[model samples]
Target: MTTKKILIVDDEAAIVAVLEELLTEEGYTIIKAYNGLEAISIFNKKQHIDLMIVDYCMPHLNGRRVIETMRQNPRYSTTPVIVITGSEKQFSNFPEDSTYQFLIEKPFNLERITETVHKLLG
Candidate 1:
């Protein structure tokens, strides 16, 4: 089977690095974006992204805006998104009908993240 491609958008370099290493070890290809604008640019160029993990507090556009923009495009309307944030209360501001089904709080365990990713990708 072909390896899945996952896009990770976050402003923290350490978070991106850790996710890249973890996901790569799991045999998935990862695309990293530092902010929402960069994430959108990557999405537009590499349109085959299989999954996306976004940080809610990113600069330039923020995660909700990124997801909303992608959802507006027919190509990504049904794509699965997992939102990670230090503040869970911020999730209430997301679109009422957004495609995201998972919210992972900050300081998450690696095992939990891996398990969630496997479940979502399946």
Candidate 2:
């Protein structure tokens, strides 16, 4: 199978490290960003990205805002995104055209995320 590139955006270094290692082992290229600014910078440079896993609560910009900004660009408008949140609040009001618009609560499982990536990319 062709390799997929996944962007993991989170403020915490631990979360980014864990996801980078996990996705790398799954044979996917990982691009990591600590904040929304960094994420946008990478997105601007990289022309193609298969999927994005973003954390809800971040320092610079929240996951929701990041996703919203991403969708504004036609290039990434259809990109699949998985929002990770530790809060009990629900996420709604996102684009419906997306194929993989999912919200995975924090303390997420590796297997679950891997399955999600496979389903979205496949």
Best by TM-score: 1
Per-residue CA lDDT of model 2 for 4-74, tens digit only, reads: 88999999899999999988998999988899888888777855888999887888787777887788788
Give candidate 1's whole-model lDDT.
0.85
In the predicted model 2, the residue pairs found to clash are none
Q: What would the TM-scores of all predictions be?
A: 0.92, 0.88
Model 2 earns a TM-score of 0.88
Question: What digit string (tens of lDDT, one per residue) describes model 1 on residues 1-71?
Answer: 99998999999999999999999999999988899999888767746888899988876798889998878
lDDT of 2 at 13: 94
RMSD per candidate (Å) reads 1.6, 2.5
What is the lDDT of every predicted structure here? 0.85, 0.83
